[model samples]
Target: MTRHLPSRRQALLAGLALAAAGCAPLPRAGTASASSRQLPQERVRAAAPFPMPDISVPDFSASRRFPITDFGAAQGDQQKTSAAIAQAIAAAHAAGSGVVVVPEGVWPTAKIHLKSNVNLHVAKGATLLFSERPDDYLPAVMTTWEGLECYNYSPLVYAYGCDNVAITGEGTLKAKLDVWKVWYARPKPHMDALVALYHLAAKRVPVEQRQMAVGQANLRPQFVQFNRCRNVLVEDVSIVDSPFWVLHPYLSRDVVIRRVKVRAHGHNNDGVDPEMSQNVLVEDCVFDQGDDAISVKSGRDQDAWRLNVPSRNIIMRNCRVKNGHQLMAIGSELSGGVENVFVDNCHFDNAGSGARSTINNILFVKTNERRGGYVKNIHVSNVSATRIAGGVLSVETDVLYQWRDLVPTYERRLTPIEGLHVSNVKVDEAAFVCRIQGEAEMPVKDVSLRGVTVAKVLEAPVSTVNVQGFVHAA
Candidate 1:
C-alpha cells in the first residue's frame, strides 16, 4: 500500500504552528534557572511579522574568567598561544562555567576550539591573528561546505556538540590570508573535487569518509562555526578577512549574533550563514562582504532531506550592509526547508562607491528543482537602501549556479515557495521593484508588496513569470 504524504500547504501550515507548539516563556537574561549550572537562558523578545518564540541565548556575564595569558600565552608566539588557548578553554570547561579571556595584545594562533560553558572573550585592544598555513587546520572535523556535510579541515574557531558557548568581546579576529587567497580560485581540480563530494552526498556516504581537505580540493573553511551546538552567542566582535563564510551557525539552535562587524571581501565570504538552524537572531551587525550579507540556508538536496531539519523562526533586524550581493538571501542550498523568517529595519549604506558597489536585491529567495523543500512566510519590512543593482524582491526557481551542468540531478523535486511579503522599503535606484521567475507547476504564491518606493527603475517596475495572488500597493 502506498502511504500518503502531506501536501505543500499542509506542510507549510504545520511549520507556521511549530513555534507556538514548542514555545515557552524563557527566563530573562542573567536570571538563575534550573539549568543555571549549564547555560543560563536569556529571553529575546522581538516583534516579527509571523508567530515566533522568544529566542534563548547563553549568558556568561557572571562566569569565572580564565585568562590565556595566565595559561602561558605570549604575544607573537603562534604555537604557544594556540596551546595556551586550548588549555584555557579546557580549564574553563573543567570549572563548569568560565570565560576564556584573551588579554589585550596581538596574539597569533592556529585554531581555537571552544567547549561547553566557555566564552572565548577577546579583550579590548586585542587581536587574534590566525595562521595562514593549511596544516594548522588539519585533522578534519565535521563541517559543511556549501551545505554538504563532510569531515573537512577544521574551521578557525569551531565548536562541536557543545552547549552554551560564545565568542564575545571588543576585539578583532583576523585571518592571515596568504594561502587562503590563492585557494579561492576554482580550477579544474577543485571543480572535480566538488563533483566527487556531491556524488558522495547523493549516495548517502558516511560523512567521515567524504573528506575534501586533500590536495587541490581548496575548500575554504569558515572563520567561525558553531556546529550542532545549542545556546550559542557571538557578540561585539570585529572580524577581518575570512577564508570563507565569516560567521556560521550550522545545524545549531537558539543562537544570537549581535553587534558584530565583518569586513571580508574574499571569494564567497558571506557575512553570516545560519544553515539548518532554528530560532536564531542576528541583530545590529555590520557586514561588508564579497557575497550576500545574510545568506540563510538549509542543507543540500539528498543529504538535507535525509537530515530533515528545516531552518525555522529566524530573525535579522537593525543590521547594516556596506557591500553585498543582497541584504538577505535564502537558498540555492536549501533542501531541508526554510520558513517564518523576518528581516526588519535594515539599511544598506551606500554599498561602496562606483564599480565596487555590489548591492543586489533586498531579499532574494532562490531555489531549483533539486532543492525539494518549501519556503514560506518570509517577511521583510522597514528597509532602506541607496542603490540596488538588482531589485527589491527576487524569487527565482531555476538558480543552480555551477551545478546546472556540473552535476546531474540525483533527485528531482521542485521547491514550493509562497507567502512572501515586503513592505515599507525604499531604494534610490534599482533594476526593478519585483522580479519573480517561478515554475509553472509550482508558481510562487501570496506575494504582497506595500509602500515599496523605488525612486528610479532602470527596467520594468515588476517582472514576473508564474506568480499567484500578487498584491502591490504604493
Candidate 2:
C-alpha cells in the first residue's frame, strides 16, 4: 500500500493562516486519493518480471575538498572563475576522487565540464550564475537536439563518458536568460534549420558533419546533462532558471535524483528528462515548471532505431508539483521503446493566478504515426490532483507540434502501446476522465483503470478511439 500524506484541506488552512500573518506559504501538497490509496500491488505489476538496478548516493566523506578559491576564482568575475573551475576539475581528476567546492558567494561562470569521480559541491550560500551570451558556449560539442544527434553548444554542466559523478549541497544553479528567452520563438530560419538536421540524421550522416548552431538553429542546450555515463547522483540542489530541459540523463544508467527542487518557467523547461536511459529513480522532489514536471523519452526516428536503446525500470514517488503542463508525460519522440515505468504517491497542485490557472493534464502519453516505438507496462497509482484543465489520463498518437508543416514525414510508422494500468487516482476537478486516441491499423490495447474518482468533470467521462481490451471498474 502506498503511504498517504495529509489532505488538501489541512494544507490550505496552513497556507491561509500564513497569509494572514504576512508570511509566504507553500502551495498545498495534497494527499493520495482515498479510493485508491490501498490498491493491491499485483493489479499494477508488469507483464514480465525484470531486475531493477541498485542505485544509491555516492560516498565522498573520505575524499578531499578542493575549494575554487585556491585556484584564483573571484566572486564576481566570469572569465577568471570559469578557468578556475576547469583547473579544479583537472586537479580532482588527477587525485582519482575528490569534491570541487564552490564557496559562499555569487560566482559568475561559463560552461563547466565535469570529469569522472568528481562531485561539484556548491555550498549553502553559493550560487553559480551562468553567462547569458550564446557565444560563451561556442565551438560546438557533440550533443543532441530534440532527439537528433549533432554538434552544438555545450550544456552549462556537462559530463561525457564518466562514472560515479554528482552535483550536491544546498545551493542554487541559475541561468542569466536574456538571450535564451528571445530564442524561444520558432521563426523561419529555425524551422529551416530543423528540417536540415532531420534530413541529415535520416541519411545517417556522421555526427561531426551534422553540426547545428548555424544559421539561426537556436537549439538551446540543457542546464545539466550526463551523456554516456553511469552511476550518477544529483541531490539537495535548488535549480532556478534553465536554458532548456533541466537535469537530463541521456544514454546513462543507475541514476538517482532526490530532494532536488526546480523552478524553471522558461520555454521547454521540463524539470527532469530521462532519455534513452535505464534504472532511474526520482523521489522527494518539488517542481514548478513551464512544461512537464517529469518527461520520459527514448529518442527520435532513424537515430533511435540505429542506436537501439530502450528506457526502462524507472520509478518516481513522493513528488510535489506546483504548476506544469502535466505532472508526468511520455514522449512525442519515442522511437526507441519505453517500458516498466511506475509512478505513485505524488501530489499535483494546480492553484495558479488567473483564468488559465490549472495543470493541462495529470498524466499524458503522446506520440504520432511518424514515431515508431513500443510502450508497455506503465503503471500509475495513488495520486491526487486539484484543478486540472485537460484530463486525468490522456494517450494520443497524433501530437505533431511544429513538425507537422516544417518537415514532411519520410516514413509513416505507428507505435504499439499496451499494458497500461491506473488505480487509486482522484481529482477534484478536470475536463475529462480519459481522452485516448490511437491509430486504426495498430490500436492501443490492454488498459485497465480501477477506483478512479473525480468530484467534478466538465467533459466526457471517457473519450476514446481505436482502443481495445479496456477495462474500468468502480
lDDT winner among the candidates? 1
Model 1 Cα RMSD, 1 decimal: 6.8
Could you tell me every candidate's TM-score relative to the true structure?
0.92, 0.88
lDDT (tens digit, per residue) of candidate 2 on 157-273: 988756667899999999999999888876778778889999998887766678887768888989999886666788899998898999899987768888999988888999988
Candidate 1 lDDT over residue span 224-271, tens digit each:
998877788899999999999989999888899999999988899999
Tell me the lDDT of candidate 1.
0.87
Cα RMSD to native, each candidate?
A: 6.8, 13.9
lDDT of each: 0.87, 0.81
Off by over 4 Å in 1: 1-37, 351-355
Between which residue pairs do clashes occur in model 2? 36-424
Top TM-score hit = 1
The parts of candidate 2 lying over 4 Å away from their true place are 1-51, 351-358
Model 2, 208: alpha-carbon shift in Å? 0.9
